[model samples]
Target chain A: MIDKEQVHRVAHLARLELQPEEETQFEGQLNSILEYFEQLSELNTEDVAPTTRAIDVSNITRIDQLKSSPNREEILDCAPEREGDFFRVPKIMGEG
Target chain B: MVSIRDLHQQLINKDRSAIEIAQEALQRTKELEPKLRSFLRLTEEHALAQAKQVDAKISAGEDIGLLAGIPIGIKDNMCTQGIPTTCGSKILENFIPPFESTVTGRLAESGAVMVGKTNLDEFAMGSSTENSAYQVTANPWDLDRVPGGSSGGSAAAVAGGQCVVSLGSDTGGSIRQPAGLCGVVGLKPTYGLVSRYGLVAYASSLDQIGPFSRSVEDTAILLGAIAGYDPQDSTSLKVDVPDYTQYLKPDLKGVKVGVITETFGEGLDDEVKGVVETAIAQLKELGAEIQEISCPRFRYGLPTYYIIAPSEASANLARYDGVKYGFRKPDSNNLINMYTQTRAEGFGAEVKRRIMIGTYALSAGYYDAYYLKAQKVRTLIKQDFEAAFESVDVLVCPTSPTTAFKAGEKTDDPLSMYLSDLMTIPVNLAGLPGLSLPCGFDQKGLPIGLQIIGNVLREDQVLHTAYAYEQATQWHEKQPSL
Candidate 1:
């Protein structure tokens, strides 16, 4: 079973803040789910290549071209906290 | 629900004005919304105005195409300019997208009226619509039961006769599972066949947007309107788009249909299995040859999807960090605190759980063991499908192990909820096309779906086979008494 400490660390890395109750609840749920995944390990996968795309075509490119864009004011209007023309946020690179 | 062709004929004959049709649709929605809760936001004014525009065009003797004046639901994840595209999550609850998704944009151009945005699981994460942060959409067949999700609302809307047709995205059976449960025709076109430019990504590599309709013919009509190469979507295929309706052969003569053995055994409901087997037999009577085939590695699809989908979701959803758009914390001293608090307050439990799983799988020293291994298994599963398809033109299976369950039955157990898509996930993994249509009903009268799966880009064959079987059965005529 995955331990509580490991759950906390994974949640932190995912940028989520789990409540105490949620942390404990997830500890059990994630463990069982993880255990189910162990069934896949029984197969030998030597010399097999990973498939990122099912149909193999990749690196598709289009010529560089200019196109009309959404209005900037409308785009910034959805921001929760915004300055005159910029999205507002708490200061970074310094301790609170 | 009436077919799109009938609606078009009605409009052309001036039997009903577009405005009249739109009002009737809204009226029907109001009468049923309390029971189904299919829509998150109803675009009454927008729908009426668009209908009026179609009416004006027809009055001027202009061609407005097949979808003209038809009211339909757009799954909330697909963007609609000025409409709130929440993805059924608190994080995007207030996000009024400034642009239209390619699918909806094409539909609008075809003169289809947008009646509203349908509900879905938060970020399309869960198997049931109960995961929606706003409201749980109920199956029209039985109010106590779920409309299978994350496209549950879309499926429910069509099944409830709220709309002629609707759009839904399928990544690991989001569209097909719900379609199976709700007793509607749902199609997931080959990956990259329909552009994913405006779909809010759960798993970019797996997601494909398609339609839900009461008839397979309508499914073809709607799919044709939105499919084609899009410069905006880098992965959009450059292949020729055919009039899929022409491929609707009434008989599947000399067609080779494979019945997947792995999907039938263990944990599947006896009634569902019986219904699927009978449906396969019906296909044989329709002049198709049926073969029982084995894809030995097929059972691993569920685990592979769990890893690959979440890993991609973690990266795609990372953009919502309480910044440019979406919900944010009101009180936080620093940026780090704000990010954490906003995400904590905004995301639902299932979304958070997936993010954590993805993070764990992709973390340092574990990437090779989980995420990479899942991808390699994905390769094996794809090869298994390729090997099976060599002898069969198409494969058929049960869309879900059981019919729609009670709303809260599987909510407590995520793994059980994941099983609802077990038979459909491998199709997504292989990036193939699949169609789910009503085949029969369980003892309680809930709908059972028969899935017809085709090789990559072979949707035409899949549709033709489904059409033949559909013509031979009366299942599609059964509607929930809402």
Candidate 2:
């Protein structure tokens, strides 16, 4: 069974903040589901390559021509914070 | 009102105006939506505007293509320019897109009306609509039961007569399961057959947009309108887009139907199993040669899907860092704190759980033990399907193990809710085309779905066989007593 510490670690890694009760509940649920998933490790996969996509296609490229972008104002309108033609955010790299 | 063909003919003959139909559908939605709760946002202005455009085209004597002025419900996950596409989560609650999805774009070019944005499981993660952070879509057949989701609202809108057809995305039985429970026709076309350009990504490779409709012919017409190659989506197939309506004939004389053995065994409810068995016999009666086939790796599908979908979801949903769009928690010390709080507060429980599981599966030490192994097993499951298809033109099975359960019955136990898609997940795993139509009813009169799966790109055969069975049976004609 997974411990609360591990659950907290995973929640942090997933960028989610969980309360004490949620962490406990997650530990139980995750352990049960992960236990259910242990069955996959038992399968013989010695020579099988991983199948990432069901369809066989790759390197699909369009012509190297520029297309007009979508209405930028409409998209930028959804931003929570923004400056002149730029998305505003909490300080990054440099201190506020 | 039931037939898209008759509606289209009337529309062409000037017997009825698109505004008249749109107003009636709007009124019908106004009355039933309180009980059904199938929609997240009804696009009354947009739908009426599009109806006016169709009316203008008809008045000008210009030919409007298929699905002209047909009122259709769209799943909330598909982006509509300036319309809310929330994916049933608060994170994207107010995030309207600047552009349209390829499927909806195609629909608009074909002249269909966008009636509303339908409800769904959060980010298409759960089997029941209870996972929706907004509202639980009730099954029109039995208001106390779920419509079966994450396309529950799409199915309910079609079943409740609020729309003639609807579009839903299937990442695991999202379209087919709800359609089965709601007694409508839902088709998850072959993976690349439908483009996913502007769809809010759930699990990229497993996802495909398809149709939910009252009849097979309506489904075909809607499928034709929304399907075709789109350069916008990298995975969109370049194959010829067949006029699917041509395949709607009730003829399956030379078809070979394989009954999946894994679908019938333990865990399948007796009533559902009995309905599936009867549907199989009825198919045999319609000139389909039935054979019992084994897919040894089929049982592994549920676990494998749980791993792969969440793993992909973790990657896809990582973009929601509360940076540019959507919700942002006000109280946060730093950027990282803002991300954690925004996501933790914004996303629903199921979405967060899947994100956590995915993060754990794809985490450093466990990568080899979980994600990679699940992908390898996915191949084995695919191979099992490939072998089954070598002898059969189409595979027949139940869409769900049971009818729509009581609203909160499986919500607490996520595993039990996950089991609802048992019979339908293998199709997604294999990237095959699958169609589910009303086959029979359980003891309580809830509809049972008969799943017809075809090999990759063999949707014609799947539709042909379903059309035959649907024509043979009286099941699809029965409306909910609502």
Candidate 3:
């Protein structure tokens, strides 16, 4: 079962701020989702080998060749805030 | 009446001009645009100009490319040079792509006239078109109901006959589910079969572009045009793409078809199940052997997909800071506030929720428990197909649990919205090729799609079998009375 504290914790970890009402709502919803996932635990996966891929395909990387790309100015032109060659924004970390 | 082959015949016979078709398609778009809302942007002037070139080529007795002058719809997620590539998000409202995606470039080279970019769920994140920041695209079948999304507009355009075909990207049923709801053919080709260069990434590992068409032959023709190696998409396969249209004969004499047992559990409505069962019976009559197969790992597909998809989404969406290639807030005093306010104001609620969930799953301590663990689980799901495919050439199931639900019904419930793709998720997780085509309709007359999944790079066999069934049945001939 999920609690208000767990909801708050998950939300914070996700970088989302949740209100008290949201925490209550999430507690019930997350628990319902968790309860559904519990059905997966009953399967006998002990002797079963974990399969990673259906296709045996590998080496899908394309060659590193220089191609004409959108200009840096065109790319940076849409930035919400800019400082020369870099995007500028509020300080995310503590005072520097 | 305008099949790809027939259009080719017309172009070859000099009876009908490609310019006329383009002009007619443009006029039809003008009539339907306000009511359907399928397109986010239409490029009629450029389209007609391209059509004129194709017509001149025909007039001069010069060879034309396949899909020459065939009008098609492109999903908004695909980057079109000089066209807005919004991905149904307000964040990039004014952003126009300066470069063309490899897929779009290939289609353009083939002389396919793109009518416009179609609407979709925001960031291709939701199942219903209701999440679109621009406008809601209605199901052509029933106007009040949704055209299942994030490729809803693509499906609706094809189903509504706005275009003979359209392009869509499927990351966990984005293409197939919408097609299923709209009564059209949608193929989510094998992973890496088509280039992903400028197709906006939703869940990078799971996303691949495919075609939505009214017939399996049209789907194969489009697939042939788009499926090839590109130096731009790092994940694109380097293998030779076989011409899929040549393999459309309705004869699967000795083929083996497996019906996955796990997909038809308690969730599917009875009407949908009945339609699928009837299709299986018809396939048996067509000289193909059918069997019931169990892949126990499929049960875990939704959970694993939810974890991996959101985790990837969280990382991919991190680039949309207000300062870089998306919407920004003018009143922001500082950098952090700029990012926060821009994202908060720019992205829709669904996009933010997914980012948050994805962020949580990939967080420092939680990565091993959630993201890593889900990847490990994804391995098991892929293995399920590996073992099952060993005994069968292909697997078949219902594409979705039910037909199109009302647009806003599940938007409020994210988990229920996620369930809309339960059957198709495993195929994406396994990276196998899957196709969804109209098999029959539910009691309410909405389309029921039969999903045919084959081993990777076996799209030819998948299409062949589906085309065979589609020809044997009258289902594909039924069009929505819009």
Poorly placed runs, candidate 2 (over 4 Å) = A93-96
TM-score, ranked from best to worst: 1, 2, 3
Q: Native-contact recovery for every candidate? A: 0.77, 0.73, 0.41
Which of the two candidates, 2 or 3, achieves a greater TM-score against the reference? 2
Tens digits of per-residue lDDT for model 1 on B1-482? 68899889999999989999999999999899999999999999999999999999999999879999999999999999898999999999889998889999999999999999999999999889898999999999999999999999999999999988999999999999999999999999999899999899999999999999999999999999999899889889888999999999999889999999999899899999999999999999999998999999989999999999999999898999999999998878888888889999999999998998898899998899899999999999999999999999999999999999998999899999998899999999999999999999998999999999999899899999989989999999999997
Instruction: Give the best candidate by lDDT.
Output: 1
* Candidate 1 CAPRI level: medium
For candidate 2, lDDT tens digit of each residue in B1-482? 36898889889999999999888888999899999999999999999999999999999999987689889999999999888889998999879888999888888878899889999999998888888999999999999999999999999999999999999999999999999999999999999999999999999989999999989989888887778788888988898989987887776788999999988999899999988898898888888899999998898999999999999999999999887899888757678878888999999989999999999999999889889998999999999999999999999889999899999998778788888888889889889999999998988989999999999999889889989998999998999977
Best by DockQ: 1
The candidates' DockQ values read 0.77, 0.65, 0.38
> What fraction of the true Cα-Cα contacts (under 8 Å, chains A to B) does candidate 3 also have?
0.41
lDDT of 1 by residue, A1-96 (tens): 689999999988988989999999999999988998998898788789999988766788867889777577889899998899989988886476
What C-alpha lDDT, on a 0 to 100 scale, does residue B263 get in candidate 3?
86
Q: Residue B238 of candidate 3: its Cα lDDT?
A: 80
